[model samples]
Structures are given as C-alpha cells and as structure tokens.
Target chain A: MSDHHKETFISKYVFSLDHKMIAKQFLITGMFMGIIGMLMSIMFRLQLSNPGESFAVLEWFLGSKWAPGGILDPNMYLSLVTMHGTILVFWVLTAGLTGTFANFLIPLQIGARDMASGFMNMLSYWFFFAATIILLCSLFVETGPASAGWTIYPPLSALPQAIPGSGLGQDLWLVSIALFIVSSLLGGLNYIVTILNLRTKGMSMSRLPLTMWAILITAILGVLSFPVLLAAALLLIFDRSFGTSFYLSDIIIGGEALHHTGGSPVLFEHLFWFLGHPEVYIILLPSLGIVSEVMSVNTRKPIFGYKAMVGAMLAIAFLSFIVWGHHMFITGMDPFLGSVFTFTTLLIAIPSAVKVFNYLATLWKGSIRFTPAMLFTIGFVSTFITGGLTGLILGDSALDINVHDTYFVVGHFHIVMGLSAIYGMFSGVYHWFPKMYGRMMNKKLGYLHFWVTFIAAYGVFFPMHFLGLAGLPRRYYTNSAFPMFDNLTDINSIITFFAIVGGLVQLVFVFNFFYSIFKGTKASENPWESNTLEWTTPVERIHGNWPGEIPTVHRWPYDYSKPGADKDFVMQTEPLKEGKTEH
Target chain B: MSTSKNNTSKQLLWIAMAGIFMFFAGLTSAVIVRSAEHGWDSIDMPIWFWYSTAAIILSSLLLIIAKWQVKKGNSPSIYVLGALALGLFFGYCQVKGWDQLTAMGMYFVGEGSNPSSSFLYVITFAHLVHVIGGLVALIITSVKSLQSKYTKDNYLGIELVSIYWHFLDVLWVYLFVFLLYSVK
Candidate 1:
C-alpha cells in the first residue's frame, strides 16, 4: 500500500491496477462506446424515418461508401443497427454499467483495501480496452461491420459470401467479442472473489447493501453465462474459418452448394440464448440494486422488505437460466418446451413484482428528496414496471407467435432492459460521482438530463408497440418497401425525433460528468449523509480504502430515519446501544 | 492480507472451477443436442484418449502423494516432478489421439468431417487448453517444490494447484464419458 503513492503517471493513470482508477477507465470507455452506439441508432433511425430522403449528415459522417449521395446503403443500414445493439448491450450496459460500478463501489462499500487480486483486475480492463479497439476498428473495414443483426444468426453469419459485411467484418466481430468475453470473465471472477473474500470484519451477507448483493449476483450471472456465449462464438468462428458445420446447414449460395451440412442453426440459438436471457438480467440486476439503494437513501426510510428484496433477486437469478427458451418459442420449437419456458418466464414476474412493491413501499409516506439520482431512480421504477408488464405478452408462446421480431418485442425489451438499465446507471453515476471524483455534479443539469431522457425514452419506445401490432418488423432498412407499412411512416418519424432528443440529452450528462470532475464544487466526505460504509472513508482516493483500521459494520446499510435515532441517518459503522437490537 | 485470506482465495478458486464446469456443461449439452439432429456420424474412440485419461488420473494420484509428503515435512520434489511428467504425458496423448482421429478419416473440418467429429475435436481441444494451463501451474509448483518452498506449515499454492489439477482431471473424464455415450 505504501508503494501506491510513488506510482508513476503511466502506472497510476494508464494500465493502473487500483480498483478506483480501473473503474474510471471502464466509465470513460463505456461512455465512448455508448456514444458510438447511439449515433449508429440515430443514423438508422434517420433512414427509417425518411425512407428515400437523403441526409447530407449521413454522407458526411459515414462517407460515400455507407451513405452514398446521402441515402444510407441498405447493407450499411443493417450494419449500423447490428453494431448499435452489440455496442449497447455488451460494451455499454454490461461492461460499462457493471464493470464501472462493480469496480468502484465493491471495494469502497465493502470496506476492503482493494480488489482481492489487483493484477487480474488490471488485466481485465486491458482486455476490455483491446476489445473496444477491435470492435471500433471493425467499423472502418471496407465491407462495413457485421450486418446480420446483433443476434448474427447462423446462415448469415457463417457464410462470408452471404453478405458483404459478413466477410472480414464478422470475423473481427467474433474476435472482438471473444476478447470481450475473456475480459468479462476475468472481471466477473475478480468481482465474485472480492465480494465473497474481501469483505471487512462485520460486512455479513445480510447486512450488506443491496448494491453489493446485486453486483455479487450480477457477477455470478456473468460467470455462468458469458462462457456459454464464448462457446457459441468459438463454434461460429470454427464454422467461418475452418469450414466446420457447427451452425451451418444445406444451402446453395450464389450458384454453388456449400460443403456445410448437418449443422443446425437452432443449436447456435440455444447456446446463445443460454447466455442471452441471463444477459438481460446481468445488465438489469445491478441497476435495480442501485435504485434500491438510492431510493432507500433518498426516502429516509429503511428499505421496505429488505429480506424480500434479496430473495427476489436470488429468485430472479435462478429463474433467468431456465427461461432462455422463451426467446425461441417461434423457432418451431416443441410446444411443450414453449409451455415450460412460458411458465418459467412468467414466473420471473412474481419476483419482479415483489421488487417493485418493495420499492414503492420504501418510498411510501417518507421524507422524500428528489436528488438527481432519486429522479433517475424513480424513472427506473416507472420504466421497469412498464417494460416488465409488456414482457408477459412476449413471454406467452401463443401471443409471441403473432408479435415475434416485431417492434412490440423491441419496445418491451428496450424499455425494460435498455432504458431502465441506462437510468439505473445514470442514477448510480450521479449518486457516486462525489465518491469517485471528490466533487459534485450540477444538479440542475442532472434534472434536465433525467426529465428529457425519461420522457423521450418512453416517447421513443412506447408507440413501437402499436407499430409492432401493425405488423411492422424490426431491422427493415426502410418501411416504405411495402404499402402495408405506409401507416407506420409518421409514427417512425415521431419515434426518431424523440430518440434524437433522448440521445442529445446524454451529452448533458457527459458535460456534467467531465466538467464536475475538475471544476464543480468540492464534495464533502459524506455529502449525502447516507449510512453506507463508503461515506465513512476520506474523500481523497487512496490505495487502501481507509488510512487506518477498517470500520466494522454493526447494522444494515439502509438505516434511514430510524426511530429515536440521534440523527435521521445512522452510518453502518455505528455500534448498537446496550438495549438496542440490530435492524 | 491475513492468513485467513488464504481460505477465501481457495473458496474463490472453487467458485471459479464451478464456472468452468458450467462452460464445459454447455458445450457438452450442445454435443448431445446436435447429435440428436440430422446428419450425425459416430466415430470410434481413439485408444490414445484412454491412455490420456490414465495419464491424468496417475498425475492426480502423484499430486495427492505430493500433498501427503508435504504434510509429513518431507521434500515433495520427486512427487511434484512425477505429476508434472504425467501431466505433460497426458497432453501428449491427447494430441496423439487427435492425430489418430485424423488418420481414421475423422477430421475437424473440410469435406471429410462431420459435426460429431468436429465436436470431438472441439471438446478435446478445449480440455487440452485447460490442461496446458494446469501444466503451467504444475511447472511453477515443481520449480518451487524443488527449491523447498513447501513444508508442513505452508503449502497453500500446492494445495490450490492440486485442487485445480484434480478438477481438470475429473472434467476430462466427464467429457470423455459424455462424448463416448453420445457418439453412439
């Protein structure tokens, strides 16, 4: 720990093993990836909205190759959409949200000196950085990026000649993803080990903050699921490179019969969804956990049903594994299997409902404060409820048959998993910025960012349900291809407008984040006056979290507004009186 | 940070091993499901795989002996070297088994290959990669053992490596049985 102060610039800022520095790295990189992913979405949305209209902005950004004479090439349209999903899901949400907060808060909140293994932590970030470089580099390839949609289903992804983007671009996508998986596994292993092994003396599991519990479960989900995705990616790589027929089958492409036979694309789908379904939870649970913490802190109440909230998270983690089949109900899977998936998928809603009720109960009749973090957290609950309710419609096998791959399904997931998680991430960022940077973010800008983002997020995704019910399929380059979708044109434009507004609002967050790091008002050590152990530490970042002996926790993290307390909030380190009982 | 932290690391190692187990479980499940689908071709088990399995088991046995020797406060260099030698031999046998499969018209790719053979190569090769990782650990342990780093009072590194080695051995056996039964 003493050697930490003598760290050189390269060691301290670049290739650093300190968990706090690594967390900042993850945050910055994730923000950059988010920008790219968002811009890609805007590009495609512009195409979807105007159809035949040419935008010089597209040509200016994408160049003549992708947006020739301003109209986005159809292939490039698919490429943008595919890259958008891939970047957002894996790079931004999974890595950015989980990687950033897990690295920052896990050590601070748990009262540990640093991660269990700092060297492996450094390796994790470098691997992720390499993956990010490779993925972004793929966009510069001559044939464009992998355009077979983010799912990259087999026949399209397997054959290089199947699509122009499938050539070298898909290979890079696989390689980049393989590296990303390695990074994620290393990071997940570190998180699990640190959480389980590195907790200070009194930080018992039940007494832990919901954020720590959420991160622990999120790490477990990543550990169990990411490898399955790796297996799927490896087989896909073999099929592409070595002519293995793992995911390839009988197909005559161009004019010749391919050597591939006997491989089932369904197998790829199975392996993918095994990781994929859990992936939604992986992205989501952390945000839910962060919201729980923020909400409890803001409302000045002990979190409602603390035990039940933990139970629901556990139930959700367990149920996430079995419900992968729900995504494949329309792939001609067995009806019995579909029924099983439906039962499991719908069962997940029970725990989810319990969690929502717990949040509302926590907030009910409390001295509520609408900090920026609280605003985003409330927005998270709203979006989570709306998105989760729609999942019931998509989870049913019979109903899914009618709306599979439509905007309805898109709307359900985007709101539930995508926007909600982003909101959760924002809440965490606003809440923890002081801890990370020792400065406060601009509250007015945060509020402005949250309001615009929340309203426009719903404005963007809400009407897509109607478009889906109208039988509008996703991934279409232009809706004007058929007159049946003519009615969707105006709705598409409206969605696009709202999406652009939502995307622009994030710039406010970016400005506030970076600006506050250097110029904002200096934050007090316990600015929020919250009860977490992280607030017990000094504002100045150090190698070992505390300068001296670590504090031993005597109570749960959510002890806000306890009866007969000296203050409204009591820190975790506060010892109980002789007659007092632990909460 | 403390002597108790060693126990936690060991626990973390086991949790990681469980994750790796699930990874292999996923690949093996794919093997089962893909076999049930059309265009299946089964190949006979290579004799070298049996040899590889025996070699890995022997290596695990030697590691157990090494652990016992360390407990008795004796230098375990001989047992450590023996286990390392056997681990390398197991890797050799696996490569030879692949060669045998290649000779028997079972290729991982190209016109001659089937999905079953491809899966066989994949599962075996993937296990081999882990085996190589174990071998690296074994080599380091051997070096440290020869230098008399382990005694009755402290052998956590050796213990951890042995646990991982045994896991690798058991994982290979599970994969072998899985492929053997599913190939038919």
Candidate 2:
C-alpha cells in the first residue's frame, strides 16, 4: 500500500483507492440522488393533491416548460414519477445501500486490509458517478426525462413518437442504466472476492457477521440477475435505435401503421421482471443484515437463531428468482403459470416470517438500548409487517387482478420495501456514524427524526390502500377527470400533507448527519459497545483498518451479554474461555 | 501477491464468466420466445461461423500449450503469440460470418429485418464483443511473456488469460450449436 501521509488532496479525497473513502463517496452521491427523487415525489404529490392547481415551487423547479402557470404538465408528472422510482430503486437503494455498506463493512468486519482489488472498487464508483450524470442530464433535454414508468415497458419505450417524453430522454435513461449495471457488476465482483478470499485466518463462513453474509449473497444476486437486465436493455436499445421489432408489434401510431410485427411486449415484461423481482431483495437484504447486527448490539443479546437468519436470507434470495412472474399475472398470462408464480410467491412469506419472528424474539426480555438506530430498527419491523401482510393480498392472482395497478400496490410496496428499506438504511447510518466519521450524532435529533418519519410515513401510505381499493388507479395525472374519484380528494390532500411532512423530516437527518460530521462530540472507538471487529479498529481513520496485524476472529459476531464475560459485549477477536464452548 | 489474492483473481474471473453465461442465457431464451411467434424467419448457419469456431478452438489449444511452457520454465512467447494470432483470426472470421449473414439477406435491422434474424445477429455480436475482450487480455499476456515477465512461480496473468480464452472457445461452440439447431 502507498504511504497515507504522502497523499495529496485529490488523491485522498477525490480518487483515493481506500475502501472507506469509496464508501463515503457512494453515501454522499446516493443521498444527493435521494434528495432529487424525494423532491420529485413531493412535486408530483402536489399535482396529485390539487390536480391542476398552481404551485409556485413547481414552477421554480421545473420552469415554464414542464410546470407552466405552476401547474405541472401531465407529461412532466409521469417524468417525475418515472425518475423518482428509477432513482430511488436503482440509484439510492440498490447501489447506494449496498455500495456504501458493502464497501465499508466487508473489509472491516472480515478483518482484511482492503478489498481484493482497490482499483476496480474506484472504477465502480466512477462508473456510478458517470451514470448519475447521464441520468441527470436527461432531465435537461427538451423532451424531458423518461416518462414510460421506471420499468420502461415496451410499445411505449420502443416508439419515440408514442409519448412526448420518449425522445432523447428515454435514450439517456437506457444509457445511464447500462452504465449503472456495469458499475454494480464491478462492485459486486470485488465484494464477493474480498469476502471469500480475504477474511482473516480464523474467520469461517458461519462465523461472519450477518452484514457480510447479506452483502455476499446480495453481490451474488446482483452478478447473476444484473446481466439478464443488460441483455434486456440491449434488446430494448436495439429496438429503440435500430428499428428492430423485438418488443413492438401491431402498432398504429399517428394514423399510420409502421412495419413492426411479430414481437410481443410480454417478452420484455418477462425479461425485466426476472431482474426486477430479485432487485427488491437486493435492496432489502443489506438493510436486513444491518438491522440484525444493530438489533443484537442494542438489545444486548445474541441475534436470535443466527443460522436461521442466514438460511432465511438464502431462501429469500433463491425464491426471488422464481416469484417474478407474480408481477405479470395481470398481463394475460396463463392461469396455470400464474398459479405457479402465486405458489412460489407465497412461499417467500415463510422465510420472511422466520426473520420477523427471530427479530422479535431477540428483542424479547432484553436490555434494550432504544438508541436512534434501535428505534429505527423497531420501526422497520413494524412497517415490514404492516406492508408484508398486504403482499399476501397482492400475491394472489385473483385478488391482484382487482388492485394490480392501483394505489393499493403502491401503498403496499412503499411500506414494505420502500419504507422498510429506508428505515434499515437510517438505522445503519445512525449506528455506523461514529465509525464512519469519528463523531457522535445528536441523539435528541435522531429521536425526533425517527418519530416524525415513522408516523408520517404510515400516515402517507396507509390511506393509499383505501384509495386503491376504491378503484383509484396509479400513474394518473389527476383524479379530477372522473367524478367518481371526487370523494377521494380529501383523502388525497391528507396523504400529501403527510408526505410533505415526511419529506421535511429527512432534512433533520441531513442536518444532523452533516453537522455531526465536523462539529459533533468526538466518539470513542467502541461507542456502541458492539461485538463486531469494526468497533475494534482505531477511532482515527487509516489506510488499512488495523495499524498492526489483522485480528483473528475467535467467535461468531453476535456474542452479547454472555454469562461470566468481562463486559456486556464480547468482541469477535476475544478467544473463548477454558471450559466454554463455541456458540 | 499472496495465494489468496491469486485465488481472488481466479474467483473473480470465474464469477465474471458466470455473469457472461447468464447474459447469453437470457438472450437465447428470448430467441426461443420470439421464434414461437408467427412471421419468424430462420436464417441458415453461415459457413464462416464454422470457420470462426474452429479458429477459436485452435486459439484455446495454443493458449493451453503456452501455459504448459510456463510450467516447464521456458519462454512461452512463441506459443502465446500463436494464440494471439489465432484470436485475431477468429475475430476476422466472425466479421466474415456477419458478412455472410448479410449476404444471405438476413438483416439485423431496417426493411429486410426479422426478429429471429435480429436475435441471431445480436447474440453473435455480443459473443464477439466478449471474444474481443479476451483478445485484449491475450495481447497483454503475450507481451508480458515475450519480456519473460512470467515464470513458473508467477504466471497468474497467463493463467487468467488462458482461463478466459478457453471459456470463450467453449462459449462460441455452444452458441454455434444452439443457434444452428434452435433458430428454427
């Protein structure tokens, strides 16, 4: 390794080969993208609540082109929704969540000096940076950003003349996504290799922290599934650019029949959902891993059923691939095939239930810390359960036929995957803040942020279920067109109010995070008294994690409050006693 | 580098190979799905694709010999150079195959194109892109071998290149057979 002392500002801060630095880069970029995505949501919610009413803030952000007279153009509403989902799902949650934690925690918890290849890690960040720029640039194009939904389903995405937002903006969206896939592949390859090969001598697979296992599995999931997305995107690109009829057929646009024939948009759906479903697990699993560790440390107990947690993760990962067809049940698929997908989809609830029960058992009859991180962990479980129950209703093809594209589906996923994953991410940030910056965040601000966010999140999404059940379809610019939806206006206003509140609460988190980075009290090495190897590292950041030899792991990472231990927590580096057995 | 670091590179290569395999798998499945539709036009297997397959297999053989020479503590420059030459020849044959495809009136796009023919073109071009990646690796390995940078104790670069080369060869053969039989 090069001498850390000789590093210049550009080398240290900009293009540094350190894993920690690369992780911080992912965090900052992900948060910036998250802010953009949230603002887009707020803008769309404003349109949804008032439906053609003027909002000066909309005019300010979108200008006269998209939000003329402060009323968001219908095309821009779809653009904001598309960009919001694309940015949050892919950029913020997938790359941001996995990229940050995987890069930060893999080497530290596994007791390695660095990733298997630091140069590739740096390349991963740059590719993501480039992809981010391209996606952002799409917004400035005359056509506006891609408005064909985040899925970019064919017929609409394939034909530029089909929609006003389909011109250069869709092309940029595809290019950005392709580049993002490359970035993730590079990052995933590094994470998998480092964890498999670079663990210190005594660290076995079973002995690894849950975070490492989750990341390793998530990386594998990415490697296997992302390439399929690349294939899908490549065909879509060919269709869009080269006049190939892969995903378009029987289309009469502008009173003219183009030559496209014999292609099925259902093929694109099949290809997309193959990656899309596993992508849900990809976003949620890392948070699950982080929450597991944080819950164990805060509750002062060994994580309930360590092997079961790992098993459930593996089961969920495997089942994710098969359950994708459930998303396509309403696409005129065969009833028998839909039944098969439904069966597989319901099977996922078994493992999910196992994980939830294990978390509850871990928190039962324990010395709970109720720290900001723990509060978020508990909040994650609550939303996970609330949102997951609705999944059962949505998973059934018969029931799903009623609420397939309704706000019910939106409400369900936001609470389950979106809210749960974000909660997990916040919990991880609060827990690891001291480790990342060597400064403590304000606990008071954290508590306030958690309470408001938790309440406001539920307040926003919970009402959407009722709206969806009342036949209020999603992706509609306004409900004013139909007199049937007139009664739901009050409910819409209430949801938007909570959404604005929820959006504002994140600023508290942002202020606390940035302020604490420089001005918060200096944190000790092991502020949380966790058993993981990361807490054993020095408070001051260094090139390699440990100053001297890497410590050898002697036990599993969940050894909290063991009988007759010197302290409440036992670091993984501590050896077993003479008569004690390895747990 | 330590043994584990070496293992890390090898493992990374294998995982990358798996990813590439999945990419092809996805494309081939699309071909199956799309061909089941009406108006599907199946093009004949081009003669040059057969020639390209043979060239890639020969290139893999030369790479294997070069790896053996490294084990015997001899300069593997000749063998590595032979492998690189054959890889270039293989790439040349692929372009010729595409020409043959066009000559047979199978267009990847435009007025004459069909989805089946387009799938064939896209799948083969994607495979060719990967072969080009392998060729770059081979070129670097050959240069290093000519400078005697690889020894019996440290030939990881050569091994990685050879592994990728062999996988590419196998991949082409499988794709060749699958396309020939499955395009109908």
- Top-DockQ structure, candidate number: 2
User: What TM-score does each of the candidates earn?
Assistant: 0.99, 0.99
Model 1 RMSD to the real structure?
1.1
Which stretches in model 1 have alpha-carbon errors above 4 Å?
A2-4
TM-score of model 2 vs. true structure: 0.99
Q: Relative to the unseen true structure, what is the C-alpha lDDT of residue A219 in candidate 1, on a scale of 0 to 100?
A: 94
The chain A TM-scores for the candidates, taken one by one, are 0.99, 0.99
Candidate 2 shows a clash count of: 0
Instruction: Kindly give the stretch of ten consecutive residues in candidate 2 chain A with the minimal lDDT sum.
Output: A1-10
lDDT agreement of model 1 with the native: 0.92
Error of 2 at A374 (Å): 0.3
lDDT of 2 by residue, B85-164 (tens): 99899889889988988898888888888898888899999998998899899889888888899999999999999999
Question: What residue pairs are clashing in model 2?
Answer: none
lDDT of each: 0.92, 0.93
